[model samples]
Target: MLSTSLRVAILIGIIVYYFILIMLLRQKRLTLKYTLLWLFSGLMMLILSVFPQLLNGITRLLGIQLQSNALFAILFFCTMIILMSLTSIISKQNEAIKQLVQYTALLEKRVREIESCGD
Candidate 1:
């Protein structure tokens, strides 16, 4: 069982985490789409911290012997999801870069042809 002080600390940390996220969003440093996952995770942590019994019940249902192990499992799963999301974003950016390069090459070729014709 988590000590009362520990739970209170976790809640404070979650609040700070949320404040940072909101600040980033307002500054346009973080997009809403990307922040959604983070916001969700923070909310989950807040709930779990406020009601540790919910996690205990879930841990028992999952047949996890230790609550810490269950927490680790959840953290790992969230990490994997974030990794996959980042990968997808990278892939899309790569494709956009390729298209931009091709377009630039085409424009350069046209400019060279126009200059040669003028000469």
Candidate 2:
């Protein structure tokens, strides 16, 4: 069971995290699509913090020996998923950047050729 102080801390952390996320979104630093996952994570944390029994039940259902351990496991899994998603997005952007650079080079070469012919 989480102590009262621990629960309060978790609640405060969740609120602060949410505030930061909202500020980032308002400043156009974070896109809605990317923020969705973070928002969901914050909501889950808030729920778990507010209802420790829910987490306890989940830990029991998962056969986890400790509630804290179960919470860590869930957090680790979510982090890995978010990392993989970001990696995929980066990879796609890298491929697109490569293609754009090649296209630009080809266009430049064609322009040079046309200018030479005009000369």
lDDT of 2 by residue, 1-70 (tens): 7678978988999899999999999999999997787888788878877887888777878898877677
**lDDT for each residue of candidate 1 in 81-103, tens digit (9 for 90 to 100):** 88899999999999999999999
Report the poorest 10 consecutive residues by lDDT, candidate 1: 66-75
Candidate 1: the clashing residue pairs are none
Against the reference, the lDDT scores of all candidates come to 0.84, 0.85
- Which stretches of model 1 miss by more than 4 angstroms? none
Best by lDDT: 2
Give the poorly placed runs of model 2, Cα more than 4 Å off: none
Q: Top TM-score: which candidate number?
A: 2
lDDT of model 1, residue 108? 100
Cα misplacement distance, residue 5 of candidate 2 (Å): 1.4
